[model samples]
Target: MKVAPLPDDEAQRLAALRGYGVLDSEPEADFDELTRFASELCGTPIALVSLVDAGRQWFKSRVGLDAAETPRDVAFCAHAILQRGVFEVEDASADPRFADNPLVAAAPSIRFYAGAPLVNADGFPLGTLCVIDRVPRSLDALQRHGLEVLGRQVIAQLELRRKLADLARARDQALAGVRAKDVFLATMGHELRTPLGGILGLSELLLEGPAGGQDGVADDLRAIQRAGSHLLEVVEDILGLAQLELDQPRLRPRRFDLDELLADVEATVRPLLRGRAVALNVGRSPTPVEADPTRVRQIVYNLVANAIRFTERGSVDVTVAREGDTLAVRVRDTGVGIPREKLALLFRDFSQVHGDHEAELRGTGLGLAISRRYARLMGGDIVAESEPGRGSTFTLTLPLAPAT
Candidate 1:
């Protein structure tokens, strides 16, 4: 039960090991594949990518071995990293340092051991890429160097993993900030809608009464009414989006005809077209699928309305079809196309098309987000494909039946 002595720079070594944040992490294919390669290349039954920490050696990947970890006192890797080159034990049973070792006397019966220390660019040895066998063995120059090269590759993979994790953390933090802002806006919109509702009521009363006969007063009140209505829509979008974010929606699925749903979406969006040349063409798919018909209409309405809002004089085409066991509803529109740089931001709240923060065609900015959320809750998703200066196509795909 003798423990291995710590390096002189034990504090720095431990810091580097911890910096990777890899100590008890799950096995990844990159590391597993490399170890499998080592086992074959070195002609050994067992291969491991071991990370030596303060009290134990953790195997990030193991091939042909059942153990996940071993005490540092019994880790051959603890001695391997002390050398600049490969450490070899042709016959561990004959060496004083390992003969009495339980690993040698017990199962796994380590008679041969060779390990190449995994060192980072900072010259700190974190662990070893080791191979073990039950019989006395040796490796030629090429096999030894192969282990070293594989060890370096393991370090490279670890560094890549650390970087990718850091990027994921940064992205999650940014998303959290956006969510906080949306929550605030939703709360504020709830508060503002009450006052705006009163304004609309008063304006209507003024237009219907003496203000209607007051000539110019009636015209000005109409403008106020329209503005109030627009603001009210924005506030509603905010409230819906906030509710979706704050709760896991429970979908109520029922049997319904797909064409019947599309009919309503077409009729609702026609008036919003306002005599524009955007023809709303919806294909007939008489598929009797069972789903939440209400949410389906909501998704269709949001997409069609969005298309009608963006296109000034072109046609908006809507199609529905049954692709195998799945249903797809695609909305294609000829409008000012979204740029490649802004495509990723399409479903995010508060993002506008063509990089315009104040585009006249912009809605509450929560329309697409809320629509996508509803679609996903029904076990479906919306995908967009567009080219700049051409047109954009948004496709919604869902299972034919309720997804269990």
Candidate 2:
């Protein structure tokens, strides 16, 4: 018996087959179903969707068969893939090439064989869809056509699966990139806080020391202290925002008097307003609301602090009220107004909007973002309304009661 020779484009065909990345893959229901259906249609006891590897012909889908693969030199499917159309042998024992083949001489003896090459779009035969019958017989015209159609279907399935796998890989990579960015920001917060603490500590110690009127030393130390203090706050804000971004922030919610909360915030902010031309207006909010008190306080504090930072000579007003089913806390500032176009960026992390001189206001730009998140975690949201010259108003709206 003579062994079947390789195709003229053997190297190209093998490369094209390997490019599919489907060899030794787990069996799929679609391919298996097609194989079983083909077996029934062709009146054969065995059917397979086979892939021709470099050293073996692997069965991707099989019916009425036990062996998963066979040596390429002895595989009838290997010879079938080399043909352009259906390759049929009425009787394998009468064919010189397969008569002495172990597959025909031993178990799963192939007497009547018919296969259609599974050709890819690139015109490479990667494998075949074949049927085998133990008795010597020939396939009818309709059966041969049906087998070839099923072979093309197998190629279509393989191509579709490859595309889906590529998309899944891309999605995983994008998610990984976002995780790495968040982790990097968190790590930098800790790294920045160390130097900021050292600078703040050293500057405070120097300021408290008795000076020899050392030229610019006193003024320099004061500037350092202010910068260090701002940097420390920014670092803390970064750390806090990172925590909120990466995980959920815990809320210790409780029932509290809205007016008393505003009073406490007024006392804390009044000391900062002492020497400034700005006025702190706390409208009467004699209403009680049920919510997380600490998170609510944090949200209000951040807004008030932000207003104070931007307003140089105008009043900063705070008002709280329960309107229907919602609680509204509005912070209005008469400092520098926000631009209409930059309003969309007000709550974005690491975003600062000071108009053309936006660069002058410095701190961790994470305050608004963190505040918004804190509000939402308690089932609320913050919105801003501003005109370029009329100043800005930030409103924090929350549900009056938690969802049951």
Candidate 3:
């Protein structure tokens, strides 16, 4: 009998299987106990947790067998992964596939075989929990059930590994973000200090020289003050982003008019829309909402900022309306709309929708994520809808409070 060629992706699967670093590593008694129980329940002479690699089957745990591995070309685990469930062969001697197989006719001379596919967390079959016996015997219904149960335990092990991998990735991403923040901090410090030094030096010169009496000196001082204010706002945003990442307390509830608050937001963002062929349309309403004032302002600012940022040549409309007991504020922009696939990741930290606008835009990618956290803290939520190449709308909804 000729051994069939492995799949085209079999090599990739083998590489990933070995990447787990479990194969050929030191054995733990936890896995050995599992294999021992499987063999005892099946009444088989050998039980092995076999990981099918490209050219070999590596045993995670082996019982009643001295050898650690065998060629995958003759591995039963290879066949087991081809199916979703267990693969059973009561008599390999009669089957054409294993009639002249070296493992069957040579060393093991195995006639009975039972294998339950071990699937990973992502539901990809990696290998098998199998039992081999020289004497041909079929498993009863109860024995088959037992093998299936053991397969779940093997899957649990793989799931644990997957969780560990995910945790490692998250930790790495967080570390990288911290490093970026450090660099930003250094740059901000230099920028801020240079301007502050200039302002201080200019003020001293003006106070001591003839420029102190000149009207232009006052204008220069005002410009210096405005620049300092803008720098402070940037610094505050960085601090707030850091606090939100650390999950610091957010709720500081206060009574505020939803209409007035929204009007203020419109006034603030309208200037950003000027010269872009974008107009601001604010919808008025008589609704009052109870929420954290600072957080609410942040949500409004970030939403409006995001709207203006994406809209190159279209209008950004802000609407505040009362629906049932909820107050909804919508910020809509006709810009480079987000892709449907990426909308799910919009609120995820550090996930920026990379596109044509990416080259012209500079952001820390933490705004939406922070806004969502703040919204949740105030017992409200933010939702988004976007059509690719058309536009996007972001809505923040909060529970409306009765007039007091």
Candidate 4:
């Protein structure tokens, strides 16, 4: 018996076949359907979608067959894969290469065989779509063409399977990376907060001590306090963002007067308007809300502070109203308005919209992003409407009751 020799690109062909990840897999209906069609079209009792491996040719799908695989040395599909087109033996018993082969002499007793090479996109033949008969016979031209067409479909399925697996792996990797980043941020934020708090405390004590009567020493100490305070604010923003991203912020909901909450927020940010010509006007009715007052206060404070930062000489207005089951808080600023194109970027982490005139007021840029996250966590959202020179208005809407 003559054993079939390997193809010229045997190493690459084996690599390509393995890359599909089809070896030794259980039968799937898609492949089984094609195998059945091949058997029916070729008028054969046995058909298989075979994949060639290093030592064996495994059947991915088979019809009228009990064994899942055969040795490569005795596999007709192995020899068939060396050709770009179908390889046929009118009678395997008469062909020197397969006449003495165990597969032909015993068991299934193959006498006739025809196979179409399963070629991949890169022109490497992985295996074959084959049909076997117990009696000597030959397939007509039409049957041969059908078999080749089905072989291409098998390659298509393999490509699709590989692509889907690749996409799933990428998705998992991206999620893992995001989780790692959140962990790193949370860790660093905690580590840096301790020293920053110490620096601010020491600077304040020095400013109120004997240094207060000194010439330029007090100013330097005050500057140190300001820088430390700003750094502390940045650290806090980072910590807040990390917590929100990790889904760790627990809302403490209670029934409270939203007007009083707005009043408190107004008082908190009024100090920010001390030196600026911007007018802070808060208009709200006596409305009661059942939600976390602290978080609500944070969101409103962020919006008001953001408006104040942008408006140089105009006014920042805050208004509140109840709409059905939701409450809307709008902060409008008469500063240099954000461009329409830049509006969508307002709520993205580390993203800030900067106009030519507002460049000097650049901040940590986490306020809006964190605020929106907080809003959504409570079943709400924040939206913006603005015209470049006419100024911008930001509206924060939340459910009146905490979402169950």
Please tell me which predicted candidate would have the highest lDDT against the true structure: 4
Evaluate candidate 1 by giving its C-alpha RMSD to the native, one decimal.
Answer: 10.6
Q: Write the candidate numbers in order of decreasing lDDT.
A: 4, 1, 2, 3
lDDT of 3 by residue, 235-354 (tens): 555666766665466477977776777778877766455347887788877767889877898788888877886778878888887878888889988988889999998888767786
Candidate 2 per-residue C-alpha lDDT over 136-247 given as tens digits, one digit per residue, 9 for 90 to 100: 9998899999999999999999899888988888989987986897778768976888888888778767766775156489778867766776676677787787677666
C-alpha TM-score for every candidate: 0.52, 0.80, 0.50, 0.75
Model 1 TM-score, 2 decimals: 0.52
RMSD of candidate 4 to true structure, Å: 5.1
Error of 2 at 193 (Å): 3.0
**15: Cα error in model 1, Å:** 3.9
Per-residue lDDT over 269-345 for candidate 4, one digit per residue giving the tens place of the 0 to 100 score: 77467458999999976666666788888888888877887788889998888898888889999987888889889
RMSD of each: 10.6, 4.2, 12.9, 5.1
Q: Largest TM-score belongs to which candidate? A: 2
Q: Report how far residue 151 has shifted in candidate 1, in Å.
A: 0.7
Tens-digit lDDT string for candidate 1 (66-143): 999998989999998888899999999998899989999998899999999999989999999999999999999999
Point out where model 1 deviates above 4 Å.
Answer: 203-404
Q: What's model 2's overall lDDT?
A: 0.83
Candidate 4: regions farther than 4 A off: 197-221, 235-260, 263-286, 289-295, 306-361, 365-404
